[model samples]
Each structure stands twice: as structure tokens, then as C-alpha cells.
Target: MPEENYDFMMPNVNFFGPGVVKKVGERAKMLNMKKVLIVTDTFLRDLDNGPVKQAESSLLKADIAYVIFSGVEPNPKIRNVKEGKKAYIDNHCDSIITIGGGSAHDCGKGIGIVLSNGDDLPALAGIETLENPLPPLMAINTTAGTASEITRHTVITNEKTHLKFVVVSWRNVPLVSFNDPLLMLDIPTALTAATGMDALTHCVESYVSVNRNPITDAQAIQGIKLISKYLRRAVANGHDVEARTNMAYASILAGMAFNNADLGYVHAMAHQLGGQYDAPHGVCCAVLMPTVEKWNIISNPERFSDIAELLGENIAGLSVMEAADKSVEAMIRISEDVGIPTNIKSLGALPEDFDKMAENALKDGNAFSNPRIGNKEDIINLYQQAYKA
Candidate 1:
């Protein structure tokens, strides 16, 4: 291989496996995380023996005092970030611990970034706009995940403007992140399916992205293989520790890939759906993955063919274009079998809104890394295709 150069990013430390939730407190204490603000959604905080309790118990054991801020919402809103920041200040917290899935992590990042940088999310909406570093954060992820646990970017929706913003900066990346399969053992099948597909999207999108390098490609390919082999098992039986563990590994790898290479049109489009409809982020990605990838296949047919093999296709003597088609078919089949809706129309979205969303999607940071750049009209057409699927 020739020498290839690209930036690689990761959390300071990652703890993986069963019972590692306890490490949150241990690591927090080691980092001198006193009076931590635990950011999460109400549902996870109320769930019995869920991620919140697991995190709380660890903090208690480590004698780390904490305050709970359970106001984060699905497709997390701008107000969620503002309220979370207020909670952090009012409680006089020194660090942050976010539990649950991507929403929780993103909310925490937004809060921490604003607390140190400024109150305006729109100001810091682009890459590396934050002036100050965030308070130390430790993310204890629950779902198979959107990979927010490790990524440096935060997605926050400005409810007033109906715009979703991605805040990308190293300042807000979790100082530490880890995945404990035990935390996911009780996850509902639908959530497991959605999050699993979310991870798969990350791998495939990054693998074919313009910013991708040899390093990210290796991680993306491994992530794709793991998701293909384990997502169904994890969705079928959350109690199956092996399946959960492998999917967790896949999430970790996917996070690393997209964190560096970044995402493509799938995330760009999904963010629009999430901001506009408050749809489940992973489900939005799941429903759009096949449609977007099919449209993008021409940009890198060889890579799509490779994704087909990772998705369990027997591509033995198939041409590149044939294998690429097989890959899109595999994505559609997996998404359908996992119970994700086949079309965006089913999400109660309006075609009338597509024009505005397409404009925003074109400006999304993820769209910049897509192999084939799309215009507002192209994005609108893509939405029409997804809606008609």
C-alpha cells in the first residue's frame, strides 16, 4: 500500500464488555469528576435497572456526587441543550456523564459546548467553531448506537427555525466512552433494529465517502461485516451476549470511521427527516439507507460491491455493478426484516416540506463528504424516491 495521509480521531479511553458500566464512576473519579451532571432522557431515567441506574450506582460507589438532568428529547431540540446547560450551571457540576443513546450524548455535548463557548448553537453549527473546550465528559452508551458515544459532533435541532444543526468540534467529544452489552440486553427489538441499522449506515457511508482513507476503510469494512453477522441476532435475542458484544464492537468501529471520514448523503438526508418530523433518528436512517446508497453506487461501484460481500452476498463472479445492486438489495432486505418502514411516506412526512428540507440537507456537514455532491434539486428528488419506496 502507498503512503496515505488523513486525520484519525477517537475518545481518550474506551472500556468495552459486560459490567463495564461500573468503570464510568471509576474513570470519572480518576479524572477528578466531582459533582457530575448526568444528562439523559426521561424514559431512560425512569426505566428500571436501565442505563441511568447503572451509571448512578457506579457514581455512588466511586463517591462521585451527581445531579440528574433528564430533559433530553428524541431528535434532541435546541431547548434541550439550553435546559441541560442551565441544569449544569445550577447544580454547579464539574463534569458530565451522558447515558442512553445518541440523543443523550448530543444533548450533553451541546450543553457542555455552550457552557464553555456560548449560548448560540447556530453560531457553533459548523466545524470547530467553539472557542473554549467543554467540561470533561464520560459517555455511557445504551443502544447499539448511532455512534455519538465516540464521535466529536453533536446534532441539535433548532425548533424555532425547524433546522437541525451539527456541531463538529473536538472540544465537545467525550473524554471517555464505553459500551457495556449488559446495558443493551433489555433494549426493545425495534430500538435494537434501528440502532443496529444506524451503525451499518455509518460503516457503509464512510467506506464510500470522499474523505475516507485506508485507516477508516479498514474500520468501516470490519464494522460492516460485524453488523451483517450480528445485528439480526442482537435484534432477535437481546439476551444473546455474543450478539450484543459483536454489535457493540461494530458500533465502536463505525464511530471511528465516520468520526474521521465523516458521513455521506444518508445522514444528511436523515437529519432533515429527524428535524422536520421528530422521527426516530435510527429508523429514519434505516428507511433511507438503501435508497441513498443505490443513488450513490455510481460514485464508487467497487466499494458498493465490497459492501455487498460484507452484507453477506455471495458475489463470487459477479460484475461490480451487479454486486453493487446486490448490496442495495441486502440493505433493503435487512431494513424490512427488522421492521423499519419501507418508505418515508409512512413517517407522516409531507412532500410539501421536501423543498425546504432538501435545501438544508445540501448544507449539512455530512453532505460535504459524500462522494457525489448533490444539489437542492437532487436532494429533493432523492427524498421523492425514498418517499415512493
Candidate 2:
């Protein structure tokens, strides 16, 4: 095989497996970070109930000073970022450690980036706007999706505009990320299923993205295979340590792929549903995955065929196009098997709002990376297909 020229990006350190949560404080100490600001949500700050307590206890045992700013919410808003920034400054924190899922990581990134750059949150809305280096930051991921912990992108909603803005920069990437399956033992089955599917969607979209290269293809395919083999098991039995471990590894692999290759319409469309309806990001991705892939198969039949084979679809003598369609069918089957709703209507999205959601999807940053460039009408049609399932 010829050497491929590709820019593969990832966090400096990715710690995984059971009992790895203990390493958070060690990594922070190595970075010379003493006083840390822990960014998360109220639900994640309850010492007895939150996963963050695990890290907090580890930090305390390590004799590292810290303060908690647990105000982050789902589809995290700029207001949350502002409040977190104040907390970071008020506590005289030298570093940041985010504990939870993407929401917590994103809020931490937002606060850290703004504080280090001394720039207003609104000014850093677009891609690579923060020119200066950010403060030392670490992320501990509890979900199997989003991959925000390891990525340079952070999606923060501008409440006034009712639109989600993605802030991207190499500087915003965390210094380290911890993925401990032991910490994921308690996530509900529904959340496990939804987040697992979101990881699958990331692999599928990145594998077929316009920016995909050989390096990304390897990670994406491995991620797809792992999700196919383990997502159901993890969802069925959250306490299955092996299943959770495979899922955590799968999420990290998928994150590395999309972090560089980027995503496609599934994420483009799902972001709108999440912002507008406050729907679970993974559920929205699960609902839209099959429909968007169906639309995309014609544009890149070979890529979809590869996906079909990876998912264990029987494509024996079928043509590429037929095999591609089989991949879409496989996605839908897996979604149903994991208990995802069959249609957007189940999420309370009305037909009347389809136009607005479609418009937003069309304008999403991830849409530009899709193999098939879709206009407003195409997006609207896709929404209709998804709405009816």
C-alpha cells in the first residue's frame, strides 16, 4: 500500500479501561495543574449520585485543589458558558477538568477557551477563531457518543439566535481524555442505545465523507464493526464490563475519525432537532441515520457497500447500489432492535416545523462535508422521509 498523506488529529493522551478514572489526578499533576475548575451539570455534581464525584475524590486523594461549576445543560447554551467562565476566574483555577458527556466537555472548553484568549464568547463562534493557546484542560467521558472530549469542536447554543454555533480550533482540544467503562456502568439502557447509535452514525458518516482518507477509513471501519458487534450487548446489559469497554473504545475510534474527516447530513440534521426541540442528540441521530444514508447511497455506492459488509450484511452477489441499500436497512434494523423510535413524530416534531428544521440543517457546518451536497428542498424532502420513518 502506498503511504497516504493525511492530517490525523487527536488528544495528546487517551486513557481507557476500568479503574483508569484514578489516573485523572495523576495526569493533572503531571501537567502541574493544582487548583482545577470542574465543569459539569447540577445533575452531575451531586457527590453521591454523579460520576464526577469519582474524579473529585481521586483529585482530593491526590491533594489537588478544585472547585465545581456544575451548571451545564444539554445543548449547552452561551449563558452556561458565561457562568462557567465566571466560576473559572473567581476560583483562580489554573486548569479545567470536565466530567460527564459532551455537554459538560463543551461547556468546559467554552469557559477555558474564552478565559485563556480573553475574548468574548460571541466572538469565537466560527471555526478556528481563537488564535491563542487555551489553558490546560482534561475531559472524562461517560457517554459513548459525541466524542466532544477528544475533538476540537464545541457546540454551544446562542440562545438569542436560537442557533447552535460550533467553535473549532486545535487549541481547544483537551490535553487528555479519560474513558473508563466502570464509570459508564449506570447509564440507562435508553441512553446507552441512543449514544451507541450516535457513535455508529459518526463512523458511517465519516467513512463516506468527502474529506475521508485511508487513515480515517481504518478508524471509521473499526468503529462501525465494534458498534455492530457490541452496541446491542451494551444496551441490553449496561453492567457488562466487556461490552462497555468495547463501546468506550469504539466511541474513541469514531471520534478520532470524525474529528479530522468531519461528519455528514445525519449530524447536520440531528443538530437542528437537538437545538429546536431539545431532543436527545443520539435519538435524533438514530432516527435520521437510515433516511440520510438512503439519500447518500446513490452518490457513493461503493462507500455504502463497504459499510454494508462491515455491518455483516449479506451482499454476496448484489450490485454496489443494492448492497448500499442493504446497509441502510441494517441501520434501521439495529435502531429498532435497540428500541429507538421509528419516526420523528415520536419525538413530538410536527410536520409544520419541518421547513424550519430543514432550513437549519441545510445551514449546519457538518452539511458542507457531506458527499452529496443538498439544498433546502432536498433537506426538506429528507425531513419528510424521516418524519414518516
Candidate 3:
């Protein structure tokens, strides 16, 4: 067996808890940043009821100059990054602050990478392709999912090919992350459930990924437990601060796990679904996760057994394989309880596109880290199961 090297990387600074948004100005000042590009989405910029304004108020109160670029969309595309780059340069922004979910943070990272390296967007597609350091980035997470704030990976879609590319590097990890549960209090139940399940997928896939290590396993297992225990409470009542806080912690732990251990076929496949169908990334993962795990259990039943236990299933009397099967069942029950539809069809995915999505997923960076090596046939089967669900 090749000895595993356990090297874990996390953001240097994390300010978590309620009202952490107020600290952004002080933190930016400490970084010596005079002007910041506040990267967000249109929903957040509406300012009628958004976290961006709260962040903006903090910056303004501190006498910091900033520009708001709120054009990012779900499943952020290369175009979003390009436009954000233009905004950054035009505003002469010295730093980047992302206030939203994964899309906004990813757009910020993309802009920072392009700004620092002067590399054409297409050139920086693969893992570790970035050669230069990116500008300092502060990510203020409004959602309890995606955890893009602390991750070194960014997913950006190519509009022409409809392919989602993953970029990984230590340089891409945000300099600081502010995770305030207060920002998530008003999120609708459906969005809450979808994003919470996304966090669960991260923990499950990272725990069983081929790249798993001791550190990641520990974090992933703990994250899974937290999500299982609290996801429903948060989904049932979005105003439950304790549930929200637990979900927030789970998001960070899951991010820490997957950030280093990497993800599996669920993410690899869902990226394609998101890019091609313009679907919610979390919904795609929620729909595909069970099918992919069922296929993966054959490769490592013991790991799945661990997942079962983490999900609060009684597996003591069962064999590892049976316990692993129980884990899949538990995932299905939780997903359904949270109102996630059982299949890709529920999300309007066409069956005819399965072949193309499978092919793209096979070529995804996350596919390389799955516990089981799947061919196109296996991928198709997983898609079919998800489609039929």
C-alpha cells in the first residue's frame, strides 16, 4: 500500500457566528486593502432584503471604498468571471469580497485568479494550473452550503462546450471567511434543504473518496453526523438558530474534508447536469447521490457502514454490506423528508441528454477521486437510476 500523506489546508482566518459581517471592514483594513470589489448576485444586490447591503454598510462605515458587481448567476459561467474582471479593473479594486452563496464566491475567485495571473480564462482550466498568487479575497457566506469560502477549488462552466471545469490550488483559498448564521435566517425552506443536502453530499463523498486521509475522514464523519442530526430541524424551521449554527459548522467541516480529500462521482456528474440543464447544483447532487453511492458501495462497503453509523442508523447487528445499504436508505429518507425530488426528471433533465452528461462527468476532475472507477456504462446506469427516481 502506498503510504498516505495527510496534508490538510484551510483558510488562515475564519470569523464565524452571528453578526460577523460587521468585522469585514476591520479585517480588510488589516489586509491594507483600500478598495474592494464586492462580488455578488442580482438577488443580493436588490438590497431590499440582502446580506450584501449589510456588508456594504460595514465597509462604508469604516470609510472603505468599494464597488458592487452583482452579475453572477447560479452555476457561474466564464462570462460572469470575465465581466467581474472588467469591473475589478475598471473600479481599480485592490481586494475582493464575495457576499452570497457559492456562485458569488466562485465568481470572486475567478476574477482574482484572472487579475493576478493575467492568464486567459481558458488557459487556467485544469488542476493546479494557476502559476501566480491571487489577490486577497474575503468570502462572506450567506448560505449554509457550498462552503466555497474555505475551499481551494472553484467550478466554472464553459459556455461554448457546456463543460464545468474545476480549478484547484492553495492560492484560490480565500484569505478570510465570514460565516454568519444570521445571514441564513431568512432563506426559504426549500433552498435550505437543498443546500444542506449539498453539504451532506460533500461529507459522504469525501469520506469515501479515493483521496481520503485520516484528517479528512475525521472531519467528514463529524460533518455527516451534524448534518444528519440538524438538517431536518433547520429545514423544518429556518429560524432555528441552533440548527442553523450546526448546519454552518457542518458546511465548514464538509468543505474542509472535500477541499483536500476531493469529491466523488456525485459532484463530477452533478457539475455536468448543472452546466447542461441550468439546474440547481445542490438539487442535482441530491438526486444523483444515492444512485452513485449504491454503485460505489461495492468498492468499499466498510466506509459506507461508517456513514450509516454517522447518520444515526443502528448497524451493530448487521454485516458491513448490509449496513452500507442502510446508509443509502437513510440518505434517501433524509432527502425526501427535506422535499428533494427523487430524480433528475423532477428537475426537468431530459433522458436523451444522459449520454452527453455522463461523458462530461467522466472527464471531470472529481471523477478521478471516486472510490470506484466507472466507465461510461456505469455512469449511464447511475444516470438512469437518478432519472427514474
* Each model's Cα RMSD: 1.5, 2.1, 1.4
Q: Candidate 1's residue-wise lDDT over 1-389, tens digit each?
A: 22267767888898999998888888998999989999998888999988899889989999999999999988888899888988998988999999989999999998888888888788888887888889999899998868898998899998988788899987777889979988888889999998999999999988998888899999999999999899888888889999999999999999999999989889998998988888888999988888889989998899899999989999999999999999999999888888889999999779999999998898888998988877888899999999999
Give the whole-model CA lDDT for all candidates, comma-separated.
Answer: 0.90, 0.88, 0.90
Q: State the RMSD for candidate 2.
A: 2.1
Assess every candidate by TM-score.
0.97, 0.95, 0.97
Ten-residue stretch with the least lDDT total in model 2: 1-10
lDDT of 1: 0.90
What are the runs in model 2 whose C-alpha is more than 4 Å off? 1-5, 47-50, 118-123
Per-residue lDDT of candidate 3, residues 1-389 (tens digit): 11276677888999999999999988988898899999998877885746888888888888899999999988889999999999999988889999998998888999999898774776777688888999989999988779999999888988888778888888999999999998999888988998999999999999998888888888998899899999999999999999999999999999999999999899999998888878888988998999999989998999899899889899989988999999999999999999998999878888788899889888887998899898998898889889887
Model 3: weakest 10-residue lDDT segment is 1-10
Q: Which candidate leads the pack in TM-score? A: 1
Candidate 2 — which pairs collide?
none
User: What does candidate 2's lDDT look like per residue over 110-191, in tens digits?
Assistant: 8887887765676676667887887899999998988899999888877886667677788889999999888888888998
